[model samples]
Target: MLPRGRRRARGPRPHLLPADARHPTGRGRADGRAGLPRRRHAAAAGRGSAPRGGRAGARAAGPRSREGRRRRAVSDFARVASAADVPAGAARVVNVGGRSIALCHVEGDAIYAIDNVCTHDDGPLGDGTLHADRVECPLHGALFD
Candidate 1:
């Protein structure tokens, strides 16, 4: 006499990767062992296509390293939010021209914008704490004003 209820399935399970991923690539990640095949990036897959960050400026080669580049004023500015969106003592992160910018509302009627990357460790500054007119990096205790 035996009493049995629900039983677990004793079979193979499906995973996210395909079966071909098991092939060796003569290298491994973080160790000197076998590694999976590397996938080609879409931007560099074709010869007829442009490169990833688009072509650099035509005059961006050879010189005193571009004091003249500043002659071209930035003519494009994207509006991320209005004054009311970021209240006082608050910070908002916005992407402008593929760069992360932190908009901080300080005191009243004044808004400051800075790159949302910490200089010390490249941490996200927008996710950090806001104090008066400075931002503290979340990863470390680095502060920016």
Candidate 2:
């Protein structure tokens, strides 16, 4: 404390939020969403039972929908590269038809492919680092599986 000639310099005032406005987990909005619009899933609100995937209430049975159907075959996938091309714990960007896809090699026997563009910022997903089944975006650190 200054006795007579000086007072302490003060910084910016601290801001406070209402108790109800604070998230219970202290990581997101008060509603527990990470800044995304709330989904209307009944189970989320504890109002109704979650739909069974075998029931898969997401769509109705119709020509345009396959809510509870099985495909005849998965023979349409084109073989773009061999597992050797994407080694273990690495990624290889390849063109299938006309789309740029990233083939992530996990362990030694599993390989997963996804769009080469990052879902968060459209960065090059293929150029990112690979860990198990997930990839870290090179541009913004977003992780995708």
Candidate 3:
């Protein structure tokens, strides 16, 4: 006896009060009623509990040992410029122990030191462009052989 708009399929119900019943404090349902849709007491009074270290206190804690290995050793012997302050093929931006040591002579007696900056961006390999042992990078030409 149903065909107009079709309506007859009540298939799942049995949940007779056991899942935290509710509707108690200030008694409602069964008709004596209060508004209804309190939404679990307004979602437990607007989201209250649950901050105890759930997802491991929301992650972020590694590198706890070995202190970070420690290794910084670049010295090899640096006085920089003494053999008459560089003049033969020219190239001299010496700082030495503090680093920034280019000091090139590249030919007679040979004096190449390298590393005056500009491994790409530090860009001051004594302004760059030595040629023999290679330098170039005056802020983006980037040769550095």
Candidate 4:
């Protein structure tokens, strides 16, 4: 049996050298034959960056691109009609901040706010038909009720 701190004799330990360390000169094997490292170089050449495609490279470059920053800064809210304006058992389309909101009057005199756009498409929920609790998308007749 092996010692408590030692593992069983299991062949050679796996090589943990970095890619650059494995190829100090960034070249192939000594025999002038192409090796795995050469294949990696060819793959990199084909894919461009280390992350592979354009999307992968962008992801590796970190978060919050310029456009994303601009979007975050832009206010998307719009003030819709008042709570008293909405009737019971119905919904009203109101522009709040800068976004369209589907103001729904559910049971217990509660107001529910949902995106005016339908999940099926970009159809405006405000122009759609409203049932007891949900609104149906008017474009394709997709029911959200």
Which stretches of candidate 4 lie above 4 Å from their native place? 1-79
lDDT of each: 0.72, 0.77, 0.63, 0.68
Prediction-by-prediction clash tally: 0, 0, 0, 8
Give per-residue CA lDDT, model 4, range 52-115, as digits (tens).
Answer: 4346455555557667642333454445677789887677887766778888886778877888
lDDT for residue 92 in candidate 1, whole number 0-100: 93
Q: Give per-residue CA lDDT, model 2, range 1-145, as digits (tens).
A: 5535696557744437644556767556665444444558876675565465455444444334255464444576889998778888888999988899999998757999999999789999999998777999999999998
Looking at candidate 1, what is the lDDT of residue 126?
Answer: 86
Candidate 3 error regions (>4 Å): 1-79, 84-87, 90-95, 104-115, 123-128, 131-139, 142-145
Instruction: List TM-scores for all candidates, in order.
Output: 0.47, 0.54, 0.21, 0.40
TM-score of 4: 0.40
**Candidate 2 wrong stretches, greater than 4 Å:** 1-69, 73-75
lDDT of 3 by residue, 69-130 (tens): 43344464645567678776667887755767777776556777778888558888766777
How high a TM-score does candidate 2 get? Answer: 0.54
Q: Which regions of candidate 1 fall more than 4 Å away from where they truly are?
A: 1-76
Model 1 over residues 1-145: C-alpha lDDT tens digits? Answer: 2225565555755544444454445233333323434547744454434544666343344233346434533466667899989988888999988999999887656889999999889999888888878888999988898
Top candidate (TM-score): 2
